[model samples]
Target chain A: MTRLLTLACAVFTMTLVGCSESGSGDDTLTVGFSQVGAESGWRTAETESIRSEAEARGIELKFSDAQDKQENQIKALNTFIAQGVDAIILAPKVETGWEPVLKKAKKRGIPVILVDRGVEVEDESLYVTLIASDFIHEGEQAAKWLAEKTGGKANIAELQGTPAASAAIERKQGFEQEIAKHPGMKIIKSQTGDFTRSKGKEVMEAMLKGEGGDEINAVYAHNDDMALGAIQAIEEAGKKPGEDIIIVSIDGVRGAFEAMVAGKLNCTIECNPLLGPMAFDAVEKALAGEEQPKRIVVETTIYDQSIAADVIDSRKY
Target chain B: MPEALKKLLWPLAALGVLLLFNTAMNPAFFSITISDGRLTGSLVDVLDRATPVILLALGMTLVIATAGVDLSVGAVMAMAGSLAAMLLVDMQAHLSAVIVLTLGVCALAGLWNGVLVSIVGIQPIVATLILMVAGRGIAQLMTDGQIIPIDSSPGFAFLGGGTFLGLPFTITLAVSAVVLTIVVIRFTALGLFIESVGGNETASRYAGLSVRGVRLSVYTFTGLCAGLAGLIYASDITAADANYAGLYLELDAILAVVLGGTSLMGGRFYLAGSVVGALIIQTLNTTILMTEINGASVPVEYNLVIKALVVFVVCLLQSETVKQMIMRRRAVHD
Candidate 1:
């Protein structure tokens, strides 16, 4: 009985030692990353980039997938806090309902870095910085490109994303704002595609029939998937997609590049998902007690048919 | 009218009203135009888009008639699409192999639900709900959560976007499946067995019916139907998006079955009614998409509200109590 008791004590002590060793080390930075689940190709790419970047930087990343539930994210945040992680990187599934858990992390002096998405907290200090693409800017770039491509006059058929989505609303706002400057570039028809290829095709087909078949000259989709669907619809209608109805969309996914290469898509604005290097840079700055900006907008690029072929291979997502 | 034809009246009427409203709104709503050796128009679009819902409702009708509901049909669609995409694009497998393996896996998924419900004696809803929740996750795992775009499979594309005899291939597939199901169920003793089993499982068992086998067969058949629907849907988009493929379509199927006058409690089933029910839904969607009020597309928020109102009216018209109430009110007024 004494031997058994001694064995239990030794095991317990070793476990405690092991746990402490993993919890923190003098030189190693442990970042607890709460991801918003593998909801899409974009999200999966973001997660992969973050993981690889963490490995390259020699930082220990404690990863947790929230599987698209806000509750799971809050639970992950609490677990990271309990483990005394050096920093917390959260790609929140939703914008709201994060204040209380973020407050707890703030009290522990752990800087939270938002990736790909941001949170809505009363106190801006809850997160050190937000590293995300400017959706509205992407829309402006698309509109500016279209205006130039069409010589500042075109009938644009806008394919919005899911209604009420931040990306959809912001992109629409930016595109409309920029297009308003061009008096002849009118939005003839605007409809929601719900951010799916099937709906995009279906809605585009109806739009073509509702307006006379040859009325609209351009389609502005919120994402590449929708743009691709629109291409099919345009082809089915006996109209050349890229030539007859200039197709432009956001999200520089590989599908967009392929469409551009095939001469079906005119242009696509990049909503860059590779934020790992920049996110780590933010983490380092925050840990060193440097003041960080409230939001760090990742630089984006516009890809047209001219550059699509050369850049297609390098595009990750 | 025959009993079956009578049951289809409400759904057909509702569909007719929607079509009339659409024609009034857009003069080209019913105009079928020949383009690129195939039919192209708003009406054809409605039929093409209705393929998935029609297929799902066909299977859902049988399952519901067996006094069991399969909630996993939508998730099974995602699984099948994911498998097809992964095989065709990622593995670069042959189109025939991809089709066989995808349908096989979907049937097995249904058999899993059947085993849980019939063999283990669990409630059908809870048994099928297991797959409904986990099926999409399994699909995501297969594709590594990527939207697998099938860019080069013209042979497979024929299932979704090809034309046959100047008609959308999808429309032909849906019609053949519906007709085949009807012939198999109505001409054989299978339909009677299903209705008997659904009417009273204990009573059917007493009468020497293999209740377990009937339940298993119906669930498996439903799974097969969902697999075909998934294939068509993925092919339509030319990609397999595990996240959104057939998402919430199971509810649409259930609504279709109900709108076709199938009771939730089970017993009677209507195959043709279910097809019309599916058409009603697709027509509603196309109408909403085509309708432009004040030069702006109809608010999507009102789409479901209008659908619900139409469904409610159809159900009310089919209700015996409601019919009696209306008749009594009319007589009193007279």
Candidate 2:
């Protein structure tokens, strides 16, 4: 009898809390965001964009940093659910083992939105929507730009990112798919740089020497950091990076934009990290009983030297 | 000649066999072509990439000989690289000062480890491990957790990337350092004292040898070597990656020292053997990177497996039991 009374009391209080949280006439919201650790500059930029956007929209945001651990994320999710927040945004570090916690959040009727990354699940209703950059498309854009620039007569040296990342896999696949159409275009060397500027440069140096800098026509890095590193290597080998060796890469950070404008790098395919506006829009739309797309893919632009000067100043990251 | 060859024979033969196998696998492995006034080929690539590991192995040989293991060499490399990059970025643009001061800082780090082991009487593994864990973190603090890239320092980069007399500057640097270290240690009574201390500390103490001093000197030498390597590595990449500057390289350095036929049991050492050991690892890395089955790059999953197998074969060849069996077979035939 005592246990039943406690359960009833807890549910009644939770309902009261929920009532106070969801205001009818007021344009206010409380959102809980669980972010993967800040390991890179791009991640830091994303976190800043979210905080400033939340402030602009006058939403009370509770943030949890997972520090690159799945258990921490699970704990953060449970905490958010227990607090009876209006919504939860999860930038998952991995694809699996999220269903159980998500099920608990679903039981509490708290919607979850995946940002920057996605979770694999059988049930589509677990997440309200996923707002992320299309990695495969980004790879295709890079390849397309390379093909058009080189006129299909390019011997490419690919500096891949961390070997196991989904972005690396999808990017390589998409780039190859596009490259398959061009008879003259070929990837002579593909080495893992492990997604750091130093390794990227180190690997590029080896590639430049082993493959003969004259034999190689271009470098396709999985990210701008690697491209920037490769540019240094090509220059050291006495080859003009933008002219002698066409440089193409992904991730349109401020550094890449500057490199493009400076004529050191030929092109960069954008993997838009500023998903704050879109994520908040999804949250607002979902809360208003409005139907939203299952996946909202953020559109990205390919920047080159021609318009790079104009867009470099406006680039947020 | 045969008697002398037996000391450093196994590792030398193993390196030779590995190189022959590499050449067979890739027909162009030994090919040397000049590109833009510099030697360009996989052979040159190996020498260029071998700089850091070669330096680590040189230091590791002495540490192992002194009956001490410096597991923090890799972390020391990271710390040194971070120091060099941060110093340069903060307007300390003097190349020679940056190199000298950074090496001095690493030497101090080495001195700290030496003090811990020699004075505090801690085990070498445990003593060096404190730095192994904390050193990279210190490096990260120096870099503010970023990969600091520098494009302005052309003179600084020449140490790792430039060619000297149709060969890599790193190769020349490694050879000269090895020669200098060999002369300094072998020509002086220091080498004999170090071997004696490692062979039997109690006896060496009774014989009026400064055992603590020997340990301190070896650890300090290892630190200085790691610092030099860190500079070359940073120069090669034109950046200092605090997180990954010398990740997991200590294990490889230990492996190289062992492969050079130096006894982990302490007493006696061969600097030449360690050089060959470093070359073996560098060649193995290049082989894996260059491996192509039907022009498709070997997947990342198989790279470690292939490398581990090479290590296994080299270790098995150097095993005492295998050596004993070979000797027994030769005696029976005679």
Candidate with maximal TM-score: 1
- Scored by DockQ, the top model is 1
Name model 2 segments beyond 4 Å from true. A1-28, A120-125, A205-215, B1-5, B25-27, B33-38, B116-123, B163-166, B202-211, B326-334
Model 2 lDDT tens row, B191-292: 899889879999999999988888998899999999999988888777787888888899989988888888887888888888888888988887776666
Tens digit per residue, CA lDDT, model 2, A162-214 = 87788889899899999999999999888887777766776776666553435
- Candidate 2 docking category? acceptable
**Candidate 2: pairs in clash:** A254-A317
Instruction: Give the per-residue lDDT of model 1 (tens digit) for B1-334.
Output: 8989989988898888888887788777888888878888888888899999999999999999989999999999999999998888878999999999999999998889889999999999999999999999898888877788887799888999999989899999999999999999999999999999999999999999999999999998999999999999999988898888899999999988988888888888999999998988888888877788877777766767877888788889879899899999999999
Question: Lowest-scoring 10 consecutive residues by lDDT in candidate 2 chain A?
Answer: A19-28
Q: What is the TM-score of chain B in candidate 1?
A: 0.98
TM-score of chain B taken alone, every candidate: 0.98, 0.96
Per-model TM values vs. the true structure: 0.94, 0.88
